[model samples]
Target: MSLLAQLNAPFMYLLCGGIILFVALVCVFFMIRAYRAGKAMGIDTTKMKRVITASATFTLLPSIGILLGVIALSGSLGTPWPWLRLSVIGALHYETQVAEAAAEAVGLQSLSASLMTPTAFSTICLLMSVCIMWGMVFSVFFNKRYLRRLGAGSKSGKPGGGFGDRAMTAMFIGLICAYMGSYIGGFVSGNGLFRCAGSWIPLGVVAVACLSMAGFMWLYEKKNAVWVESFSIAGSMILAMAAAVGLSALA
Candidate 1:
């Protein structure tokens, strides 16, 4: 059997599902433990429930999007790698780029199930894992200190507050610019990168998402609807996905 076929074998799914189940159990254990701790400390259980509801509602959309990403990558890389990466420290935005970079480094233009060999698959997996490990290592060692410093600065409410806000804004802007620039460059270069009709779908999706979010924001301001703010992200995601489908069909 081919490497891709092996990767998609039943054993891989069982292994992936086992790891994911263990992680989920660990997460639930900690959550329940924390809830018990709060109860012992006489924290209001009612307020805690409310907080949990709001947090879960906010997180649901993004988690769905991440699952969609895992599905997308699974078609090419199989289920185990994407499932493991995304279930842990992996960000949705970084997975494709990491795969693409790893593939390029191995003298492949891109990775696909049909074209991949065992050696190439293993190399890409190792490279992507190692590349992300630096961030995980730093977080393990320095995350507490980083949060402490941030808290101290916020309390000061001077250069700390302003600088923190600006820094975060700049960071997000930089990330968006980098993603957008890469797509724009690919389209402009047209070196077979944009040759496929489906290549334009991502651009359409982005535009649709942005426009939907902006429209929701405007409506929120005018109508003073509290739910609009909550649903904005979800609405944009759904509309963007629909737009992608429509655009792909048209193309």
Candidate 2:
């Protein structure tokens, strides 16, 4: 059987569907438990319902981005895998990066379904599943201690007050800078198989995304458009993707 055929096989779909259903059930169980606990604590049932409704509504908007990510990856990785990944604990950027790297490692120029073999697909799946588990493992084992340390630091009122928040902000900024730097470097160095006029497309997409995000932030901060905050990231991502498609076609 072909790689794509294997990936999108009936068993693959069944497995993915079963896992997703299990996760959804688990989430629902937790939500029910939390709701009951809130009731015990004398929180108004109506307020709780409202909170749930608002959260679900807000979640739908961000999930548009996730849907887009799944569509983007489906072309190369097949639908079932990407759907399962994005529907569960996967981040779009992390999955894309890992998939691309794994493809390269398996001697594929990129993650094209046409070029993928069963061996290459297996390698990508293994790497994606194994490498991403460290974060979850660390959280499970050390998160409490890390949180306690942060709490202690916050209470101490020392020179490094609010160090946790600052550190998180710094880490986020560093991550953004790292991605931006890689994009710029790739464009400048004319590296890999993408050494063409099309190589600049990523940089252009990044610029559009940045500008879209900045514009949303401006609306939120200056015009007090509170609704823009929730949509900012997802909207920018969609716009950036559209820009990429247009640029790719033009290139």
Candidate 3:
């Protein structure tokens, strides 16, 4: 059978659907447990219900981006896998990067459905599933210790009090720089996915995204637009994607 056919097969859908259902059950179980625990702690049931309602309402906005991610990935990787991944532990950026890397490792230029094969698809699925688990595995063993250390540092009021926050910020900055460096390199060397004059598209899209995010943050901080916080990331992503499409057309 064809790669897309295999990807979207009945069994694939069944497997993904089963996994998502299991996750939903686990979430519901935790929700009930938490609700009971809150009552035992003397928290009012009405307040707890309000908190739950607010949490679910806030989740809807971020979920739109996840839904968009699934749509973006579904064109090449198929619907079931993307749906399962994003519904579970996967982020849009991480999934796209890993999938593209896996496809390239298997001699595919991109994650395009037309360029994909069964082997390439398997490679992507394996890599995406396995490679992203290291953080969770480490957390399973060390998260408590890490939290204790972080708490101690905070209590001490020393220069190291902010170490955890600083470390996380540095890591995030490093990741952004890595991606930006690749885009700049591609722009300069003309060695990116688009070797033509369009090699700068990635950089351009990133710039647009950054600007959009900055505008949203300004609105939130300066204008006191409280609702902008939830939409900032999703709004920037949508704008960046639109910019990419426009640039691609121009190219």
Best by TM-score: 1
**What is candidate 2's lDDT per residue for 182-238, written digit by digit as tens?**
777778776655454327888999999999999999999999997777667767877
lDDT of 1 by residue, 24-100 (tens): 99999998998998999788998677567657766887798899989998988998889887987688989988998
lDDT by residue for model 3 (1-251), tens: 87888889999999999999999999999999999989997889987876776566657656887899899999999999999989888887898888888888889988899998777788888889998888889989998898786685355655564567788889999999998988887787665454443387898899999999999999999999977776677678788889999998987
TM-score of each: 0.64, 0.62, 0.61
Candidate 2: 10-residue stretch with minimal lDDT: 189-198
What shift in Å separates residue 68 of candidate 1 from its native position after superposition? 5.4
Overall lDDT per candidate, in order of appearance? 0.81, 0.84, 0.85
Clashing pairs in 3: none
Arrange candidates, best lDDT first. Answer: 3, 2, 1
Task: Tell how far residue 231 is off in model 1, in angstroms.
Answer: 0.7
The true-versus-predicted C-alpha distance at residue 32 of model 1, in Å, is 5.7
